[model samples]
Target: MIETIFRTVDVPAEHRFEAMRENMTNVHAPAHLSSAHAIDFSAEMRLVRLGRLCVWPATVQPARMWRTPRLIRQSDPEQYHLTLMLRGTKRCMLTGRQFGPHEMHMTDTSQPYEVEVVDDHGEIKMIGVEFPKALLPLPADQVNRVVNRRLPGQQGIGVLLTSFLTGLTRHTGCYRPSDGPRLETVLTDLFSAVLAHHLDAETALSPETPQRTLMLRIRSHIRQRLHDQELTPATVAAAHHISTSYLHRLFRNHAHDSDHEGTTVAAWIRHQRLEAARRDLADPAQHAIPVHHIGLRWGFSHHAAFTRAFRSVYGMPPRDYRHATCRPAGPAH
Candidate 1:
């Protein structure tokens, strides 16, 4: 299951310092400054973790200003941070670049950066989406040029980017693991569109960037064959009329370049199968089907292998995952 972290900060006149300090610690804020307010001040931040990505929404009130000092630092497992302002104003500076308001910017946590939040008696609201750098298809040099720099959000691709983000934030919960593949596609397109717009090089992009078209096709094919126990690189390559070497190249180019990258195709197939099995296990409509049958239906030939894979992926064996998901909230008393 996905994990979500929600935090709220309300600082009365007397305890404002304490509240601010606590919030800073929570966000791993490098440094902060606040002005004395006659009235109370408050802020709210919500963080949602989806596999390798994280989304955060922040709101602040009573016109207090917060800044990260030069010496402050922060780190994360994520590769990039995208910040979009929903309401009010915020300015972030990194590598001598600045971004604010309707504009969007990306930050590399490995480097030192500062964000200035200015309320000025008004409210401030912002949303931040963080994901792995590998998820983006752009070259490192091109990506570097855009990072920490404010991109225009006034017309054309900017409008599309804004609309997509708004919709994504509002409707994320409606998506299920079965929908993960689709969501990943949408994210790829949105990121591509945004980058192409900023670089003024949309026309320069190839008809099939490996990360965009090729990987997408491979993932779609994998999802369709999740129920086929014989699915393998050889079979998949044959289906696509491509050589196994070509298939391996595609996976290596799109996924990370780690030792695990060699097994990505198989890993992807297993992930989809596990997701399908989990759904079937929790679904009352399928309660009549034996767990072993459900595993078989999702392409697991060996019950033992399925049990081990299910446990490794979901932190429990099939029966245990089903029982927990199917359990009642509590006794009525």
Candidate 2:
């Protein structure tokens, strides 16, 4: 049930200026449109919504647009529209810079800002993800810094987000209706992760923000070392430049009502190691490998310990789970 919702308009030569103006308004926030040749203007807006997020993919010709004070006085969506240039160029007065392909910028529709597309023939394409301003859940000051400025989308989470969005737009029909909540959560979290990385927000966000941020970082670190026999709380904390006590506190804050009731940080490492072991056990390429060898690869100290841990989590030992999941080999090739 991937829903594809789109809007398009081709402003006639007779009413190009006026019609283009209206089209631009609906594409984002209301704005004033001015162009020497607005005639034969063309624009198309493709939107895919997973819950409240509107993935507005836009393509249009050259024009000068502004979110003026007067326009804000009349109407405003108070949304943050993050734009990534797919092709062509743009000059923004707010940031006083030019954005070329693959670079991103954020525009707060609630504020007064102006931009001009640089394409002489008036053809440009880009993706704009509109986030409800009230729902961003980020520090206003930090958001402002990244809003008008160009942010890199070629590295780290930016790369992941850019690839996700590129694929998302290309495969909008593949998403199921039931995927709304999960997709919405992914978009929000990815957005938060990107902006937080830019803002160095681990220290700037609220108490809970740092805790959540730390856990995410810690988890990534743990995943990379699931096979390390010495991946204890102390080692994990030292690698992250935090104390062992503080590391335990992170998982605690993220867990049960009583800090003592939830699984300790050390236990989480063990569980993750066992989970990795089970995955290796199920992998067809590793079928010839011994089960105990797989356990040792994932840091299990003994055959019995790995078996017990695997059974506790999956209601069966590693070998049994693999037997149940792995299909028999068919005729060669």
Candidate 3:
């Protein structure tokens, strides 16, 4: 237990990119940095070491891009980061997943990844838990299954995990030194449950747990493959090793299909696609990426179809929306 140790680091606005690079590599993982607007950046991180797990809350300004291969020259530690997006958004290019407020994202440091801050608002805040590779009960392959995917903070183990991580920072001053090991155990158990639930490896979990885990895994699968033109009910069902009819039953039991009268699986996928596209189109960093390209990036096949769908939901064309949201491009700071 490392309850006796608490540290905080900050990068002032005038410090520029090198300061950020130094801070991140020393405090978190080593990564390459980009963004001429880095001169506009500032950051702060508060860390609490809890045995094998470290809980930290970070707040950063101005959008930034990070790539691990940029500065890493030696062996990469097998560390996994479970991040809760407290405010703003993050898009992991490696998986094409975008995490919004109240969502949790798992990232493995061993793999080279590209992540960019997605909030147009000045800064982003998040609670991140960094733990050793073995601390996660599941095998490496199992962790890979959930990495880069958005885990909802609203329900199931996600809710508990999110609350616990955030509460650690909030009540750090109250915990006694003896609580470190206990806190470490709680962190491992909760996060392990979150991972097991998502991977459907809940064989040792309660019977009822598997059903909820299955539903969540189904939703994750749908979101992950949203860009695939061939993504369909049958494919999702097949991928899960369940019959197409049983898949409908699962969704029906979870209130996602016909007779249950909620958003159908297809509708949910469409909503996610549009939401992803909207984010990209609104991103200041994507100003030069073209409206149609943004649509295509999120799985829209036809320009006309993308435009119709974009206008249908937001009442504004993609072009107009980008024009309205993005600032004029200028010399990089």
Candidate 4:
């Protein structure tokens, strides 16, 4: 679970806004914050810290937050704040843009900017990440091109980054402290790809950035099409317009040998398919679905084949696994 480092629910309603404001400036960059509903404000912040990057998912009352020249002089983290709005609307004076749910906007903490909820009343829900400017792998001036600009999170690399942040918020406890460095790398690459795409500067990225970015794109493609029985390495390569050999090479270079032997493209595909089926088997809501149908849904052509694969990984047949984990369909207590 993501850690609730700061939450206003426990504080007196009259003091909740001030508590939130204090935590924000202390944990993030220095900024001035105010809310029209301070007397009855309610908010929550869930945070996860990766190496040099930190993500915070917040549910906050309508408020105005800004950094002025004076605030900048007082303190500057020299970080970039990328906010993915999950609900409500916001207006940013830095880019002269207004955005709402499923859209993203970025700001450089080194510069003065204003970000305020434009809604007359309601909570503004957003997930944000702050990372040092040096982690971007691009020149500061080039990165400024997107500062506070409305970015499309519904399509392209923006979708991947947004999905990643959303997943992290939901499953933060699934990770260990040792995972920080790798998670940091993945976030940096995805963030870099989004910024580079907007600037038309893909070639400006560091040598390792493109390879890591391509691997992520490939993994995403594979996951999306796992239901297709024809989703072989060759077909996957064709979809991405790369040769099958090159795809195999990419997998070999990036395979997680420390865990399982998913060193080949075919093995990776099978593993993902089995994992999907496993999740369905464990879901109580899906317990009524036939074991064979669950297998077929995830690209296993025959019941026996699915059983063998599932047992090989999970040490039990799908039906038995489901029986052990899922209770009979009935009313909740």
Candidate 5:
């Protein structure tokens, strides 16, 4: 199961910053943490354990954290820390870099570094993943080339990695402890792919990596185009330059690893479309949108078909589902 490693709200206000520092040290590596506004510090962090790799999703107050050469010698986890900035900016003097929203930075625990993250108006939101340096399939020299470098999270393999990280963080309840090994394999492959792509060292990845990475890319592609009415197995396969039969086999290859009911391409698309329409139906802000219109937006062309499909999965028609979850606006106060 995933863990909520820390929440400032659980600690006394005066001690929250101190608690955060201690938790960070334990979770990642030893470092000194200080904040100009420590009295009002607040944050909530969740730790998702994927086998030997761990991801930390947090929204924290402005603070400065640094590791010295002395601290590195004292206790080095010998881990690589990859951090994605979701909603703030951070400046690092050692790397001579500034990362804005949607950018990522990598750090080595064996080296000294310093970072100051801030958002003057609110808290800083970030997700960080740490794994043993030895777990990466590439050589240490190749890995060293990319450390302290800024990686963009908005494109290519980076998109796949960021999506997987954020999805895991947001839906921890959907996974079980037993799912750790499978999730870890996917996480490691994607991380390796991202690093390899940056270093022009794709050939260094293991033989199984390309197939797994391709599957992840296919899934990501399918998700982004779920709203299109033409989304189907053929269209999806064409986009990826693969045959439809090959796509089916790809899904078949991993059927046992997933708890999802469907493994075929058509089934996967239908499931995604239904889940998306279901969220829109339950959303209060979308209540003003008609049920059939919401269905159409997610590729369900017919009202009766949409109702039948939605009811089959959700145990109720879209209208009833909406009514049960969304209270009608009481007369505007």
Candidate 6:
């Protein structure tokens, strides 16, 4: 869910300074503004929580020179902030680096920094993502060098980074709990790609940590190659530049104690194939495809073996399972 904190500054000459100061302190506005005349301004901010990550969109108008304190506190459990300016211009300085419009900035609440607004007349829109320092895969020192530095948003890694943030914000509601780990992986990749473009050392993200990432990659690869007859463990491992034995080790590492690791992998593959075959069998739109062919299309080389495996997994043979699932029941038993 998303929570919003919105306030508008429309005080006349008498209260402009007080109103501006209150807003600056409350929202932690990154600029210092001094004005003599009365001002009318409004700003809307929304922060959406996604697991350990937070996405926020902010829009403000009625430009004023404002300075944000270096030791800004965060309500989030995360400590790092990444901001992308969507519209208007902003001059941000942190760790002795300056950033402008369409640029990305990283700020650590543990440190202090200053930002100045250059063109506040126009609508200023920004998207900020907050994450924990531990969640970041890059080394702290390497990541620190880029903090407050202006990264070009027009090309290369910046474009990809922006696109991912925009897409995530737009579709955050549709994401499910099952997708959390995968989403984290995607975010990690995007961050890595960004750091790589900047030529920063990523020793902090050493690949020896959790098995979740390798498993996710392996699953994605397997799904994509499910239809190919040559998509064995050796082929899959070679494609990923890992040895077949290591790939087996990864699968074994994740399997339950009672199941043979190879059998577990094979069972998962068979189950997916069976599910795809069942969908094809039941789809009136795909009525022309033969049931056996549908099974073959999903990596089942032998019809008898496919049928037996399907029955074992689904409690019925392939044809019977298809009939029971696809056809409407006359009445409940």
User: Using Cα atoms with residue i matched to residue i, what is each candidate's TM-score against the true structure?
Assistant: 0.50, 0.60, 0.57, 0.92, 0.89, 0.51
Q: Which candidate's TM-score is highest?
A: 4
Q: What is the alpha-carbon lDDT for the whole of candidate 4?
A: 0.85
Better of 3 and 6 by TM-score: 3
Colliding residue pairs in candidate 1: none
The C-alpha local distance difference test score for the whole of candidate 5 amounts to 0.88
Extract clashing residue pairs from model 2. 61-122, 62-122
TM-score of 5: 0.89
Question: For residues 1-333, what per-residue lDDT tens digits would candidate 1 score against the true structure?
Answer: 143544344335567555655654444333445544424556666655545556667676633333343433443443666778766665654344544567777766545556665555567787777667777666767876777777666565565556556655665675665444545555556666677767876664555543454455566577778888889988988887888898887776656322121346777677778887998899866766789999999999999999999998788899988887765335458
Task: State the lDDT of candidate 3 residue by residue for 1-333, as single tens digits.
Answer: 343322123445566567767656765678777764676556667768887778878787645555466444465667888889988988888778888988998877877778877567767898878878876556888778888888999887787678667767886875666677667766776677788878888664445445655665676677678788788888888998998888776665656212112456666677778878987887888888988888887778899999998898889999999888887668879
- In lDDT terms, which candidate is top? 5
Which pairs of residues collide in model 5? Answer: none
RMSD of 3: 15.3
Give lDDT tens digits, candidate 2, residues 3-72: 4444334444677567657655775778878765565566767767778788877787777888888889
Question: What overall lDDT goes with each candidate model?
Answer: 0.64, 0.74, 0.74, 0.85, 0.88, 0.62
Task: Give candidate 3's whole-model lDDT.
Answer: 0.74
Tell me the tens digit of each residue's lDDT in model 6 across 1-333: 444454444455456555656655444434345532335445556655555666677776534442334333432233667778777666653334545667887666555655544444656778877667787777677777776767777676577677667766765665655555556555566665566568545344556433534555576677777888777777888887888888778777655321111334666565557667877777766665677887889898888988887787668887776666575434558
Q: Of models 5 and 6, which has the larger TM-score?
A: 5
Worst 10 residues of 4 by lDDT: 253-262
Candidate 2 — which residues are off by over 4 angstroms?
Answer: 1-20, 203-333
TM-score sort, best first: 4, 5, 2, 3, 6, 1
For model 5, state the Cα shift of residue 39 in Å: 4.1
Residue 74 lDDT in model 6? 32
Instruction: Please list the Cα RMSD from the true structure of every candidate, rounded to 1 decimal place.
Output: 9.8, 7.9, 15.3, 2.2, 2.5, 9.4
Candidate 3 segments exceeding 4 Å error = 1-16, 69-73, 204-333
